[model samples]
Target: MSLTISELQALFFGLFGGLALFLYGMRKMTEALKATAGSRLKNLLAALTRNRFTGLAAGTVITALIQSSSITSVLVVGFITAGLLSFSQAIGVIIGANVGTTVTAQIIAFNIAEYALLLIALGFLLEVAGRREWLRHYGMVLMGLGFIFFGMELMSEATRPLRDYPPFIDLLRQTRHPLIGILAGALFTTLVQSSSATTGIVIVLSGQGFISLDAGIALIFGANVGTCVTAMLSAIGRPREALKAAVAHVLFNLGGVLLWVWFIPNFAQFISSLSPAHPRVDGCSAAGRRNASADRQRAYFFNIGNALLFIGFTPQLARLVDWLVPARAELDQPVQPKYLDPYFLSDPTVALDQVRLELLHLGQRTLAMVEEGLNAVTRGGRQRLNELRKQDEAIDTLHGEIVTYLGRLSLQNLVEPQPRQIYEYLAVGSYLENIGDVVETNWVTDGFKRLESGVNISTSTLRLLERLHEQVCRSGKITLEALEHNDLEQAREVLRSKATYNELAEQARTHLARRLVVVAPSRLDAFRIEMDLIDHFKRIHTLFRRIARLIEVSVSDSRKTSKSG
Candidate 1:
């Protein structure tokens, strides 16, 4: 039988449009769910992925609620960024997403087409009639459900002629060729971009009895590989850790495809022998073609089987990904803020302006480290020190940023006035950062070791110190604001509070010092802990002084401006 171009055109448009509708609906549903879920989706991964079991359960429920595995995976990346879950913990979540995604297949398989219009009307009502997030959620769910069902029905109707078209059947026959079939499936899913949609089409075609089990399984395999593309796209501008997550997704799916390709015949027999029914292909008559419908059901099973096969290896697979793209090593040095140049200033004047900005940025970084150190001694079971190192890195990054900006500025031929202003800013930035170092130097790295090696602060003393820490943080904030805005009034208040907090903080030390000398037993560790908290408050006071100085300089500058004016 000769094939007409119009028949091919009809088939192409139908498939393309069906796939488009499926993908578009998936995107809308994903964004709406994420928006509605807000930070709760983010917090879920953080609290949930502590262990593989929890991770899996969380992933399943979250993915099911979100209705898109891609959204679930991206949320995992956010959790990782927030330091909520480690890369390893993310593995089970990804694996669970596979199972969660099957909800789409199950939903699509239901005969909701008859109710699509009614469902859409209800969805519109919910959308127009509600201030509640749950109602909005229900509205989005209804809309997605309506769209998916309607699109599937349109696809089925449009492709009805393919059942009788010898040429169309001949093309579908290529699905029996594992490479050709897998490639076709992968390409279609990649282009249409939803494994669920691809799998849904397989169900519809199988139910129609137009494609055999062997063809369906090959496409299912292809759909698995195709799913990774979205993750890969997300990794474009992200850090290496993010890239690894996407890579893990790819490697996990690709490995499954490779394993199944070798055992294709065995897998095919398993899927086909089950003869799971495809209700779509049974459109002609539910009583006829039970075997073909079974083959289609097996097609879906093929996807699940492969995902199950890989889920076991998710942890082991994470290790492989780690080997391929190792976690970036922890930086050993205190990074200067100068290293973090915005690098935006290409012109001499602009570069100088950037240098000044970096100087401020650098000061801010040091201020953060000082802030964290204040908490480390005062807060119980201070988080892993390395975790607090981000505060230090923030300082170092700014130092590097400023230095780089300065170097670029120095290379340029600056005018008389700007050069002095740039130099003064650089000098001020360096001085402020030195204060940051003084604060850093006060951090008892060994002290924490000596303390946690089991030194206990008395309950009364601990409570007093906690209150002191609170007061010190206030002083720090006040000082920082004063300096940042050059507010002399805030600066004086910061200094006054610093003196008051220091006197109180110092009194605790004096009591410790006297106890050590008289009635105290030589629990030198306890003494050190008391002194550490005392010193923490001391550094807080010092940060305030520096900020006060910044305010003083700014005030003097204003006076000079007044004189010039």
Candidate 2:
């Protein structure tokens, strides 16, 4: 009995929809896994740039854990965009990610569908009985995995009709034409959005002896190029560094495909021995490919060979990619995400790096502004207080940015000392944000307000306020340096200055108290403004104290470090 064309189309559509469900389920599972492992991943990844081997391991482990290289690459792109991981470091991570991506293919090659239900039971047990969030995440991952295997089984079963279709065999036979097979493989992977998944399907088909070695290699090569579509798509409008990293990933995979395409027969022959097969005897020619045997070793050999071919060459190719894209034009605005950066929390290690950089920017900018403000207030230099105020606002904006970046980073990076550092930076960023407010509040903002009120201060009061602002500004500079260099001695100097600030403030208060005792009502505005000036003097003390505490924490962490060492 022949299936009608329309009926066949309906069946194909249903299969397509099932494939979609399977892909969607995998996506959901990957996301939940990442979310569950978010804190650990963030902390681990946050400190990633310590070395290349570490970075590669990080990429591999994340991809292995997440079971998705596409996700891994997306996370890498995010880090690069945020200035967390540099291009050189990211290249290593991608290498690890390539290794990790092999996990999916390996899983599918296991033919685990018969026991997929077993994991589902374990998944249910963990979901109900487990207390740890990670166990729950693991449960979800297992359940999703069970479903993945189950879905693949159903998909393979559904496609078995092709075995009976002569026309289908004829079409598959045309896969001998490398160009046709390449396009088919690429289109198939692009349609699926998962090179690993699509390639897994091809591997399974090859195992079943439904396709030839030539066709299998073609599909694998096509899948390599096709995988880049995801990286390229995710990286659009990202920073040049991110774009370059994504492009680097694309180039490496594509380069492997190009290199292997020339030597496909040799590769197949070299590998085909591991899964030794009887030559094809059936009219459809199934005998040589499957041999009705499972050869895990062959599968492993394929992965190792492909990985080395790409990773081995990636270092040199990366430089070529960098040259190709180059840097964007100067004066080009940085990429500012409308929402919180997806990549920021996607990899906490990278996000933490970004926050640190932003903080460094804040430290430098605020330090400069505070110094300028000090000169203006103390030395009667042209009142650049307004300029300083604007710089402070820029600092505030950066703080807000860093805070936003950290907030996302914290969600994923909730591990110990690093999380605490993230917290410290968050607070420091907030404080820096407030420094802008402080600059404007006491001096530039309200200073103009006091001047507008037509209140004239005596020379002594003006000189006193000037000295107070100077001391506070100097303390601000020292605290920034102390925090940056982790210098306990420099930090202690802040405490040393505090007593002096308090003494001068007390003297001003005492002198003002005496004047108030003799002053008449006509000097009321003068008295109020003088008090306002005195209030700022006391606030200088408050600001320095806050900065001192932050520095002390850094110093305390250092002592812990020294003792541990």
lDDT of each: 0.65, 0.66
TM-score winner: 2
The most accurate candidate by lDDT is: 2
Residue-level lDDT of model 2, residues 148-215, one tens digit each, is 77666666665566666778777778887677777887888788778766765675566555777666
For candidate 1, which ten residues in a row score worst on lDDT? 338-347
lDDT, candidate 1, 1-565, per-residue tens: 6547997787778866876776666765665665566445556766888787788778878887777776676666655544567878898888777767766666676666789777767877887786875687678767766777777776777777767777677787777788987888888787866787887787677656666656667777888778777668766765566678788778767877887787766765665555454233322344323543344354345545656676667678788887988766788866543222222232243344345445555656655665566456545354645555556556655655666567666665343344555666665666666655555455546336545666555676767666676776676666656654557788778767756776787778777776675454546767776777577567656755665665666577766854884
TM-score of 1: 0.59
Model 2 segments beyond 4 Å from truth?
4-14, 32-58, 74-86, 276-303, 306-315, 332-345, 352-356, 359-364, 377-385, 392-430, 449-504, 507-534, 537-565
